[model samples]
Target: MLRTPAAMQDAERHTAHNYHPLPVVISSAEGAWVTDVDGRRYLDCLAGYSALNFGHRHPTLIATAHAQLDRLTLTSRAFVHDQFADFCRELAALCGKDLVLPMNTGAEAVETGVKVARKWGYQVKGVPAGQANIVVAEGNFHGRTTTIVSFSTDSDARADFGPYTPGFRIVPYGDLAALAEAIDEHTVAVLLEPIQGEQGVVVPPEGYLPGVRRLCTESNVLFIADEIQSGLGRTGATFACEQEGVVPDMYLLGKALGGGIVPVSAVAADADVLGVLKPGQHGSTFGGNPLACAVATEVVRLLATGEFQHRSAELGERLHAGLRALIGKGLVAVRGRGLWAGLDIDPALMSGRVACERLMERGVLAKDTHGSTIRLAPPLVITAEEVDHAVAQLAAVLAD
Candidate 1:
C-alpha cells in the first residue's frame, strides 16, 4: 500500500484543503470497487456522495455519453438541443410533475426552487416581493451556494460566510409543531431533505414527511423536497418522499440523475408553481446540453424499472441486521433506509474517522460524516454477496 504520509504531503502542497478525505487517491473504478493510485482495491461504500448510483463507468451510460459527445456535446440555452426535450419529458414523467427546469448541479436546482417559490408567492400567492420567507429545517444540506448556505444551522457552513443572505427561517427537523409555528402569511415554501443524508444518514421520525406535507397543503405553503441525495432510487424508492406516500409541490433532484457521468440536476413541479419565472429570469449554460440530456434520459429509465431500488431494499436489510448483531459489542446504534445507513460508534471504541481508516486498511472505503457516525451508502448496483462482504469487514474491524 502507498504510505499515507506521501499522499497527504502531496495533497497539502497541491489541492485545496476543503475536505479531510481519506488518504486514498483513487485512480480508477468499476461497478462497486475502486483502485487507488497505488493499485490497491477497495469497495466504494460512499459512492461519490450518492452521485454514483449507477456505479463508476457504467457501460451503458458511458456508451451513450460517448456517442452523444461525438454527435453534439453542447448547445447552450441560447437555442435548443435535440436531447433536451426527451430528457426533460422523461424526468418529468418519472416525477409525475407537469414540468421541469434543468440545471447543472443540486445547488442550482435548490436556488431555482427558492426563486420560483418566492416569485410564486408574490404573483400567485399574492405576497409582496422581498417579504417572501422560506421555512427550512436544521441540519439540512441542499448544496453549498450562497443562498443555500444562508439557511444552514451548522457553524462551520455559516460562520464568517456572512453577511448571510436573507428571507429564510429555520425549524427543528421532524418536529411538526415547530414547523407549524414557523409559518406566517409571508411564508412561501418549506424546504427539507427527505432523509437528511449528509447528517449521518439520519431518518426523520416516522410520519414526519407526511405530517409536513399535510401542513403545507393545509397552510397553502409550497412544500419542496430536496431529493438531491435521496432520490433516484438511493433510498429504495424513486424519491424518498414515496416512503411517506406524499408528493411535494416541487422536487429538487441531482446526483444520481447524471448516472455518475456528468452533473445533471433539475426542479420538477406543476406549471403554475414553476411558471413564475420569465424567459430571462434564470438558466445555466450547460444545463440541458445534448450529452447531459442523453445520459440523464437513460438514468431515468434505469431508475423507473425499480431493479436497483429492489436491490437496495433487500441488501440494506441484510447489511443492517448484520451490523445490528455487533451493536452492543462496539457500535452505538444503526440507522438509515435502503442501502444508505449510518453506524454510530461507541466512544470507548474508535472515532468514526479511526474506524474509517481501519476499514480502508481492510479494503472497504467509507467516510465519516458527523463526529461518531459513519454514513454507509454503497452503489445501488452492489449485490447481496458484496453486501455480506462489507458487513464482514465491519464486523471484523469492530471486533478488534
Candidate 2:
C-alpha cells in the first residue's frame, strides 16, 4: 500500500480546515518539479504563490542557510547580529532605497508599511492624530491580517472578520478618476499591488500607475506599492512598477526574499519616509534575525545579478504566447506578465477546481482562485521546455 493516502489523511485530520488543498502529497521538490511519496513526478506551476521563485532547495540559498546555521541564529531585536547590516544595506541598494526595515512575513511588511505611513502622516504630513486614512483598490489582496481583511472586497475574507478596523477607502482599480477623487487631505497613503496577483494576475491599465504616482505626489500622500507578489523578478522587471516607470514612496517586498528557504520580508524607503519610527514602535521577535538576514542576503545577491529578471523577460514572452494561443480552446481569457499568468477556464465546461484536479492527475500542479480563474506562477528558474510542458498539460485538460 502507498503512504500517500495515509499522509494526506494525517495532514487533513490534524490541520485546521482553512485550506482545501488538492489531493496530492508531495515528498520533495527541486528546481521546478516535485515528487510524491509514490515516486510520481509533477511540475510545480504555482511556486507557492511566487514564494518559491528561485525554486526549491536552490543550491546558493541552501548553502547560505547551512553556513549561517553553523554560525548563529536568533538574537531577538535587543542585540545586533553580524549578518543584519549587510543584508539591509544590500537589499536597500537593490531596491534603490535609503533604508530597509526587515520583517519575517509579507503581512508583517504590510503592517509595518501601514504603521509607518500613519505615523508619517501625523508627524510629517501634519494630519491630525487618529485621522489618517489609506486608500486601497477594489479586488486587492494584501494579506489576511485583521487590518488587511478590514479593507478587503472579498466576502469570504471579510465576512466574519469584523468589527473591522476603519480608515481605509476603497477605489476601483485601474480607474484614475475614482482614485483621484478618493484622495483627500486626510489620506496618508495609497496602498496597491503593482499587479493584483490574487485578483487573478490582473494588470491595471497603461499609465494608471503613473497617474497614481503623480496624484500621490501632488496630494502629498505616500504611494505604497505592495510588491510582495510582483517583485523579485516575477514580473519580468525588478519591480512591476518599474515596467511603467513608477516608483512608490515605500516598497513592501516578501515571498521570494528569503529564497524559499526561510520567511523574509521588508519595507524599503528613503529616510524621510521610513524615518518616522522610533525604537520600540513596532517589531517582531524573528524579524531581521541573523538566519533570515543571511539567507535573504543571498537572495538579494541573486537579484542584483539581473539574471532572473532577464530570464523572466525573455521566457515570459514565450509563456504568454503559449497561454494566449489557448484562447477559445478551453480558456476564456489570460492575463499576466512574465512567468505568472491567470487563466480563466470556460465556466460552462468545468470549474477551476475541477480543471486543477484533472491537471493534477496529469502530473502538473497548479492553484485555482475565485470561481473560474486559475493562477500559474511558475518559478523564474523554469525552463522553456517546462513552460511548454505546462501549457500542453493545460491544453490537454481543457480538451478533455
lDDT tens digits, residues 1-400, model 2? 8888898899988889999999889889999999999999999999999999999999999999999999999999899999999999999999999999999999999999999999999999999989999999999999999999999999998898799999999999999999999999999999999999998999999999999999999999999999999999998999999999998999999999988989999999999999988998988999999999999999999999999999988889999999999999999999999888999999998999999999999999999999999999899999999999999999999999
What's the lDDT for all of these models? 0.90, 0.94
Q: Which runs of model 1 end up more than 4 angstroms from their true locations?
A: 1-8
How does model 2 fare in lDDT?
0.94
Model 1, 147-230: lDDT tens digits are: 878899877777787878999999999999999999999999999999998788889999999999999988899999999999
RMSD of each: 1.2, 0.7
Please report the candidate that would top TM-score against the real structure. 2
Give the TM-score of each candidate. 0.98, 0.99
Once fitted onto the true fold, the runs of candidate 2 whose alpha carbons sit more than 4 angstroms away are none
Worst 10 residues of 1 by lDDT: 1-10
* Per-prediction backbone clash count: 0, 0
